[model samples]
Target chain A: MRVGELSRRSGVPIPTIKYYLREGLLAPGVATAANQADYTEEHVRRLKLIRALIDVGRVSVAGAREVIDALSADGRDPLDLLGEAQYAIAPRHRPGRESPEWPAARERVVALVEARGWLVHPDSDVIDLVADALSAGDRLGVAEFFHNLEGYADAAVQVAAMEVRSVLARPDPAAQMELVVLGTVLGEALFSALRMLAHQHESARQLGFSPPTPADHGVNPAP
Target chain B: MRVGELSRRSGVPIPTIKYYLREGLLAPGVATAANQADYTEEHVRRLKLIRALIDVGRVSVAGAREVIDALSADGRDPLDLLGEAQYAIAPRHRPGRESPEWPAARERVVALVEARGWLVHPDSDVIDLVADALSAGDRLGVAEFFHNLEGYADAAVQVAAMEVRSVLARPDPAAQMELVVLGTVLGEALFSALRMLAHQHESARQLGFSPPTPADHGVNPAP
Candidate 1:
């Protein structure tokens, strides 16, 4: 296949495909002539993955490049590869002047990790994320949100365990790595949507509204 | 207090605070004179909330305005206010041309909601979110990811229930609405970070690596 067919089949514009190629996000096609190149089914597959990462997964182009590089790199441990994907997708945080609340937040995070007996890198972006949320909660006077932490952690661990099991079951390392990356990225979106739906259900119930039956169209009034 | 003191107290720069003021993300300060405005402690509080929503919660300027407006709207039902906040923060999706897989994905979501006896609106953003994720998983050939859906839903419902209980416990409608907005936004970040940490711990355990103790520094040896 040529770039034109690749673009048509992948639903990506030719210019975008060319940009991806130039950005090292897509592997270079075989140079068939001075102005043309022949792509393979693998290229089609790679293009789709790139679209999924950037479009659906909402990863930045640079992040997608790192992820693709990590995916293509052979002989790396699966766990390390997973770490690289996590690092790549993790939101970048600007360093801020140390605040009065950070120490307490850090201590709380450390205590939570220790209490759970979960081993994670001390420098993991998650550490900063957890601390940031805690600090923000404290400042906003919503510290009660942390009261739900234990429950959230329990659910988080269960989902994480299931994900690790699924990833480990894959025989091919490349396939396993791809799953780790996509699963981590898209999985967040999935969980978020589900959580919102669950909130709607729970809020309705708490407010004494009955569940809406299928018969209820546009306006789902409480029965 | 005045705008300058409010800026100093909130750690938000004066110009940015002015921008937020201009954007209607923050309420106007009481006009004491033609050129000067007097801001109250309430102004300080509102400024912090705006910062948390925009900076930490990552809500857009327009979205933040909707949220603040929702909070300030008197005599609105708490549940309705929460719905507004959720809508403000919901990821906007562009409608796509109908595809073959969408029917199946939509069916799966509908069935999941029915089975769970959830009363969510049929046209809820969350429905699209779930369907999109399902379609993306199918295209990515990771359909097995749905095998974890039940577990994920269980966890999601638990967290959602906790959030609702906390919101309902708040006596003030405005405060309750503020929490709903901040909780939905910041809570997502908190959960994602926790999930990553949990994944790290689970992956380490599955790979036969021992848990890291606090004393163990830099080099976490792979066993």
Candidate 2:
């Protein structure tokens, strides 16, 4: 298939596909003539994955490249590959400050980790994220948000355990790495969305408001 | 007592403070004289909140203005104000495509809600989010990711219930509104970081790798 068919099938524009080819995000198709190349099913699959990462996962082109490289790298530990993908997509945290509240917030995070008895690297990216959020919560005078950390952690660990278990069930290392990346990135989006819905439901119940149903949207039932 | 003092105290630059002032995100300090205005403790507090929203919550200036307005609005129901904040911060989902997978994904979300006995509106922003994620997961060929939706939903509802209970405990409507906005935005970041840590711990245990401890980073122990 030519780039035109690939673009049509993948819902990506030909120029974007050519750009991806230029950027080495997509492999070159076999040259059938001087000005034409033939793409295969593998190219189609790769293009879809690239589109998914950029569009749905919101990963940068460089990040997507790193992810694709990790997926294709051979002889690397699956765990390390997963780490690379996770680190690539993880949100960058601002550097820590020397403010008094900063230290207190760091202490709170350490306390929560100890109480939870979870083994995580002290300098892990998550440590910074947790500390930053706690510090911001303190500054905002939202003590109650921090109070719910334990409940949130409890729920977090449950989902995390499930994710690890499911990903490990895959016997193929490459498949495992792909699942880890996709699950970690897209899964966050999914969980955040679900959390929002849950909030809506709980708030509606508390406020005595009936939530809109599918019927309200005219979503027809299956006949 | 002045804008300069407010800047010094809040660690936000004067120009940025002025920008916020221009944007109506921060209320003006009382005018003491021509070209001189006296800022109060309220100004300092509001400045800190604005910084936190911009830095940690990643709320845009416009979004922050909406949030602040929601907070200061008079005689509005606290829940309604919270709804505004949540809506403002809710992650925008891409419009659904007219494809078989899209409708099937929507049906999956609807079924999940019914099975869980959740009271969320079918037309809620979260519905599109869940459906879109499911469709993406399906397209990415990761069936196991969707398999864990039930667990994610269970955990989400627990956290959401705790959030509602905590916010409702605040008697002041403005404070309640503030908590809702802060929690809805920053809380997602916090939970996501925690989830990453949890994943690391669970994966390390499964893979028989020892995770780095606080001692590895020379983090001082509490005396």
Candidate 3:
């Protein structure tokens, strides 16, 4: 198929496809002539995946590149694909003073995470990462809050892992790989949006607040 | 009090306090001399809130600024705060593709969302946004997978909204607000992780596959 047909079929435009090819986001099509290139089913599939990462998953071009690389990596475990992608996009920390209470709080989190059977790498920064979030909390009712959150993260890890693996079990490697990305990437945004709404509604009922109006941000503002 | 003392009191470090002031993330302390500034309780409170945004909320400085502006906006309703924050972080759209199917899909979604009693904007984009996701999903065995997801999103919105407003109903508005940010932001991550695992597990059973190995992002070659 010509690039035009590829664009029409994949819904990705010619210019964006050109950019993706130049940026190594997509591999080059076979050159039938000096200015003609032929695409294939794989191209269509890859293009759709790229579209999914960008449009639905909200990943940056760089982030999407990393995800696609991991996804298509030969013999790469899905778990590692997810991890590599996460590590790449993980927020960079500004080095600073560590709180004296940080270690103890970290221990508490470690214990909680372990008890919940999460696979925390021996050197995974998530321990310190979470502890920093806790310490940064400064007794603003976050210690207990994190305590609950740690448990939630544990349960979440289990649930998401299971869901993704189930999809990976599909006989079609294509579908399996497709779900792997969906369950991990786009799935995050979907559930995040859901959790935000869920927590808000629950909080409203318990707090006896009036039905939500448009002006709440003025009173509550972003944290 | 000195910055060190305020650090101890607020659980924010001296350097972070400096960073905050320099960034205008926090208001400056009362000036005692050319090189001296005295910290106050307001500094303590602001410091904690900033930490919440950075660490627990995992919001970037620019995003934090948006939240802060909304929060500081005088005479705004709380509901607006939530909506505005969502707007800031709402999903992005593609450059051009007028697929009529998206609006129809979105209408179904809106009906589902409204049935759950969410305060949704009467905008059409949300439909397009969701249709994009469903369209990208080629492997979700069920034809009405988008509808299923809408149900999920609707339920999530209701639950999250309730949970958040419950905090606002607390006796202390500050604590309520703090918890709201913590719950919504952190809860977003946790819930998504859970959904990922759950969906994987269900998909596996239906596909007749073995359970996935434990969650390790970096590991052995694919099994």
Candidate 4:
């Protein structure tokens, strides 16, 4: 297939596909003629992953490139693989003006992870990411959210263990790395959406809202 | 307190505060004289919430205003409150080009929710959100992610129940609304960061990497 076929197959516009090519998000196709390149099925697949990262994960093109790069990188040291995967999951935070609440919030994060016996490096940018979110909650006058930290951590640890097991089960090393990106980026989107629905469900259950039935979704029960 | 004092206390600059005020994200302070206005403690807290939504949650100014409006709206019917809170969590998705996989994925979502016995409306945008994410995973050629949907939904249900309980425990109706915003936006951020750290910890444990010691974080473990 050429660019048009790739675009049609992938449902990405030609110009945007060209843009992704220019941004190195999609690997170059083999040159066939003047101003023409032959794309394979892989190009179509990569385009979808790029859109998933940009549209769903809100990751920058640069971040997407990093993830794509890590996806192909196999047989690396586990620590190095973890380093790149973490970077892809949460892009490094830019330096910003520090709030007065930052230190205490950061300490709370460090303390929580320590209490959980997590073996992540202290220098992982995720520490600051958690701290930043904690302080943002504090600043919003919703410090009550902080009380739920242990619960969140417990759930995360359980979910992460399951995720790691799933990824490790992939037979191929490249497939393993690909699952890392999927489980990190799309996984969050899926989780966030489900969490929203779950919240609505819980609120309804607790507040006496009637349960939605098969009729609500066009499913008819037998008479 | 005047606008200047409001800026000082809130740590938001006067210009940005004026921008937020003009955007209707912050309510207008009491006009005491020409070219001056007296703000209140409520203004300071609102400023923090506004920044949290914009800076941390990446909500647009208009969306922040909607959330702020919902925060002050009390004693509404539970369904109405849930409607408004759901909007606060997810700014409505704009219509976009649909992929071929959309219908099947949407059906899968409906089936999952129905199986869970949730009481949410069929028209909730979150259904489309989950569908979009699922199809994005399909497009990315990671259909293996679909297998984990049940697990993700499981965690979401448990976590959402805990969150709703926490929100309901708030004595004030308005406080309950505030917790909804905090739990939705900041809660996702907190979860994402923790999930990343957990992934790293799990990867290291499963891959036989050595754990970081107290010295790694400058805490000396007492022998």
How many collisions per candidate? 0, 0, 57, 0
- Global Cα RMSD, each model: 2.3, 5.1, 6.5, 4.1
By TM-score, the better pick of 1 and 2 is 1
Write model 2 residue lDDT over A1-223, tens digit each, in one string.
9889998778789999999999999999999999899999888778877877777777789989988888888999654665677777766546335566887887777777776656665666667677777777776788667786789889989999999998999987866877888888778878888888888778767766654464563222223
Which candidate gets the maximum DockQ versus the true structure?
1
TM-score of each: 0.93, 0.86, 0.70, 0.90
- Local distance difference test values of all predictions, in order: 0.80, 0.77, 0.57, 0.77
Ranking by DockQ: 1, 4, 2, 3
> What DockQ, between 0 and 1, does each candidate earn?
0.63, 0.49, 0.26, 0.56
lDDT of 4 by residue, A1-223 (tens): 9899999887789999999888888888999999999999788777877776777777888888888887766678655676686687574553232777888988888888777767777777778888888887776777776678888887788788888888888887777876787668878888888889888888878866666555575212223
Q: What value does DockQ give for candidate 1?
A: 0.63
Give the candidate order by descending TM-score: 1, 4, 2, 3
- CAPRI classification of candidate 2: medium
Pairs of colliding residues, candidate 1? none
Model 4 TM-score, all chains together: 0.90
Superior candidate under lDDT, 2 versus 4: 4
lDDT of 3 by residue, B1-223 (tens): 8788999887777887887788777778788999888988877876776666666555677676666566556655555565555544444354323564445545655565556655444452334454444444433232222334644564455445445544555666555554555555645543543343334234434444443345642222324
Candidate number achieving the greatest lDDT relative to the actual structure: 1
What is the descending lDDT order?
1, 4, 2, 3
Cα miss at A10, model 2 (Å)?
A: 2.6
Which has the higher TM-score value, candidate number 2 or candidate number 4? Answer: 4
Give the worst 10-residue stretch by lDDT in candidate 4 chain B.
B214-223
**TM-score: which candidate is best?**
1
lDDT score at residue B66, model 3, on the 0-100 scale:
67
